[model samples]
Target: MAYKITDECISCGACEADCPVGAISAGDDKYVIDADTCIDCGACAGTCPVGAPVEA
Candidate 1:
């Protein structure tokens, strides 16, 4: 499953750099993970300070 970024995201851009597939992007309100491009590696989740990334 792909990972989803929750509203708790701080948009600090840490997760974006951790995403191996470049699935994470900056959104209007927060960082978003492109489900189609995500590899489900959980790298972004590990890097998120607010625990915004979760399995979807």
Candidate 2:
């Protein structure tokens, strides 16, 4: 499974920079994770201030 960003995301761009695979991007409401590109490294999860990133 890959890492996903939930609706709890504050669109702070913190998780996007943390993704080693560059799987995260800005969405209309929140930061989205490209599941195909995600490496499940959990790097984004740790950097999210609102705890928006989770395992999918």
TM-score of each: 0.96, 0.95
Candidate 2 C-alpha lDDT tens digits along 1-56: 99888889899999988788899999889899999999899999899899999998
Q: lDDT tens string, model 1, 1-56?
A: 99999999988999999888899999999999899999999999898889999999
TM-score between model 2 and native: 0.95
Candidate whose TM-score is highest: 1
Worst ten in a row by lDDT for model 2: 3-12
Task: Please give the lDDT score for candidate 1.
Answer: 0.94
Steric collisions counted per model: 0, 0
Off by over 4 Å in 1: none
lDDT of 1 at 26: 99
Score candidate 2 by lDDT.
0.90
Best by lDDT: 1
Q: CA lDDT of 45 in candidate 1?
A: 86
